[model samples]
Every structure is written in C-alpha cells, then in structure tokens.
Target chain A: MALDYALLVLAAPASGHSSLTAVRFARALLARGHSLQRVFFLDNGTLTGLAAAVTPQDEHSPLQQWAQLAEEHQTELILCISSALKRGLLDSTEATRHERPGATVHPAFELGGLGLLVEAAQTADRLVTFG
Target chain B: MTAAARKSILVVSRHAHPGSSLPRSALDTALAAAAFDQPVALLFQGEGVLQLLSEQDSRAAGVRNLRKVLDSLPLYEIETLHVDAAAAAAFGLDRDALPAGAEWLDAAGIRALLARHDHVLGF
Candidate 1:
C-alpha cells in the first residue's frame, strides 16, 4: 500500500544537499505512487521559496525543480510563517501585513503556521525531516 | 481524532545551542505537535544536551533564551523530555546543571524511545 508522506525541510539549498535530497526523495516516492501530503519548509529551508533567487546556468536549480514538482504533482509546499518572516521571505499577504517592500515567496509555496506541521505529524503516515 | 488515529511524534535534537538554529527549531516542532494534541517526546542527544543548560544567557549570544522555551514545555503538555546521559556528561553537565523534569536515558533507552514513536524527526 502507498504511504502518505510529509516532509519537514530545515536545510537551506545554498548550504547543503539536504534540501536537494529531500526533493529527489519526494520525486522518487511520488513516482512509486506514495501520496505526498505536504512539504513544510522551516528555518533555512524557507529559502527555497525565494522566487528571485537566480541559479547559475550550469547548475541544477533545486528551486526550479521544487516549483516544477509542485506544478506537475499539485503538491502542497508550505513555508513556516515565523521562520519565513524571520528569514525575510514574504508572500503578497505577508508583505502587506508586515509592510515589507516586496514579497519573495514563490507562487508554488504558501506561508503557514507551525500548526500545519503539527497537523502533518498527526496525519501523515510518514513524517521525514531533512536538515 | 481517535486515540488510535493520533500519531505519536519523537523529535531527536542533536545540535548544540548558540551556534546553530536546529536546537530551537526542534523545540518549536515539539511544542507545535503538543499544541495540536499529538503525543510528542523530545530527545536531546549529542551536543543538543547543551540546550538544556539552566544558566545560559541568551543576551550574550544575541538569541532568544531557549531556557524560556524549555520552561514553557509544561504549558504545552510536552512532558516527555529525554536527555542522553553520556552526552550530558561529555559536556560536563550534571543533573542539576540542566533544566528540571528531564529524564536521563542511556543508549538502550534512546533506542527504545525511537522505536516507541510513530514518526521520528532528527534535527
């Protein structure tokens, strides 16, 4: 039987392979027919939601890959609201609320509270963390 | 959710305080789980035991005092706190040196705690 999976990503793409590993793992599991309940970004992991981040032409962009995964698979990509705000990542709603100059959150992701992470823990068959 | 439907979560914090963000993140996760009524357990291993130090002054580090968060554990109903005995001793911390209400676990006890939870998050 296919298991329901939720991922907690704590490593930033710039610092380590943990975020990339999580993306690949997500793809692999989804390919095997497992249901991805959500991918919650926390701490530095919220950096993945930077739509303005420009990747070098030669490198594989984990950012693009993540966005594509959400576009293709209809996956829920959520950034921890507290972590995201602290890291200066804002969606349009958050930007307006916080009076920020602009929003940096990618369209594929939504800013949510830690309660969503708790909900995932309670509901998902597997809760995985990468940091 | 029914009792059987509620998944138990184990957060294994394995980083040191002051230098890294993982320790705080791990505790936030544990608190969030507890807030949602999920049975949550927190395990401090490796350098993570340093976070339980009662005398840490966050002002010096320019970070929020994690001791404050530790103190709020009871309020969140997250009572199951485990500290690796060897890790604490390695850092020269005695029982009274850290926060109260934390249970000391040996290697085997750590293994059992990992096995008891439905999901384990290592930070």
Candidate 2:
C-alpha cells in the first residue's frame, strides 16, 4: 500500500520550473495511491494563495491548478501568515485586519501560523519541500 | 513509543549567508518546534552550513541577525544540529570552524539520519 504522507510545497507560482515540478509531483503521488495530509505553503510559496494573480494567457495557472487539486483531494492548502503578509497575499480576515480593499487569498487556501508547518513536519509520515 | 507514534522532525537549511535569509526561517521553525518539546533535528548542507560559522557580521548584510537566533536554540531545548561533512568542506569549513553546538555527519550518516526522521522540511 502507498504510504499516506504530507508535502510542503514551497515554490512561488511563477518561479520557473520548480513550481511546475511540485504540481506534477503532487499528481504523481496521488496516482501512485498516496495521499497528502496537507500542502503547506511558505515563503514565496504563499504567492500561490493569491486569487488575483494572473498567469500568462499562453501558460497554465498553478494557482488554479492548486485549487483544483485541493478540491479534488480534499487537502488542506495552508499558507503561512507571516510569509503571506510580507508578500501582500492576504485572505479575507487578513485583508480586513490590514484594511485592504479586497481579499486577495484564494478560497482554496487558508492563512495559518508557521506552527502548522512545524506540526506537519513533526507528525506527518513524510514531508517533502519544493523550491 | 510504537513505530507509528514516535515523532521525529528534520529541518533542512539550504541557504547561504549575506545572499539569502533562509537561516532565519529555519531557526524560527526550529524555535517553534522546540517550543512544543518536539524532537527536532537540523541538517545543514550546501550553503546552509555557512550559518554554522562562529564568526559572522550580519550588520554588514543588514539582516535580522540570524546568528543570534541560532544561539538561542539550546534555550528552547532544541539541541540537535547536524552538518554534512562534504558540504562543510565544499564551503571550506571543518567541524571546528562551525559553531560549538553543531555535529558533523558524512553522506551515509546523513542518509541514515534522514531515515530516522518521520518528516523533513527544507528551508
């Protein structure tokens, strides 16, 4: 049986090939019958949580891809609050707190503390980082 | 603890000094894990070993003084620090050149150590 595991995807959506590599790896894991406990986004990876980001017309949007994957797998997509705030990737709660005009965080991702990342690293059967 | 119940966390540091500030992220994560009394071990390889150098002037880099952050590890009960021997040599450093607390491990040692950890997170 495939081991149930967790993955920490740490690449920004627009950050060259590593971003696509992470997405492809996620799909491969599922196809091999593994499941992710959560997909933790940190540092520039938090940019993937932005709902307003627009990819090139000719390119696929990893943000949309991530949302679709999370929906299909029922995986928790967590973006680190500190990293997100620094990069201006704000969810509704954060947008309201910062008095921003509109919430920028995609609904598929949730804003959380880095502690969640720690928890995932400590408890998950496997934690792989991308970036 | 049973095979499934034991908690082991590996924190990987891959960034170098004065160029990127990933050590701060690694240290912060270590502190957070240590706060929970988790058995967290740090593995420094590649440029990440630069973080272990005893002498560094973050003032020149105008960074957040990650050296000070690393010095606080033991206070939080996080003491396991590992450095890849090859990585250290590649950076022109030996175990003695690193800070007093870090332990050196070879490539095979690194692989074995990683196998012991339940989860691994690279910063």
Highest TM-score: which candidate? 1
* lDDT by residue for model 1 (B1-123), tens: 678899888999999887898888888888888877889999999999988888888897688888789978988888757999999989988797666679999999989999999999988
TM-score of each: 0.97, 0.89
- Residue-wise C-alpha lDDT for candidate 1, range A4-64, written one tens digit per residue: 9999999997776788899999999999999897999998899999988888898778899
For model 1, what is the alpha-carbon lDDT of residue B26? 89
The deviation in Å at residue B24 for candidate 1 is 1.4
Candidate 2 on B1-123: residue-level lDDT in tens?
244565877889999865774666667677777776677889999989888877778787667666677777778776767889898988888566665578889989999998997777788
Top of the candidates by lDDT: 1
lDDT of 2 by residue, A27-130 (tens): 89898998887888877788898898899989989988889889999989999888889889887778889998878888999998877877776566667888
Query: In model 2, which regions exceed 4 Å deviation?
Result: B1-4, B94-97
Clashing pairs in 2: none
Model 1 residue runs over 4 Å out of place are none
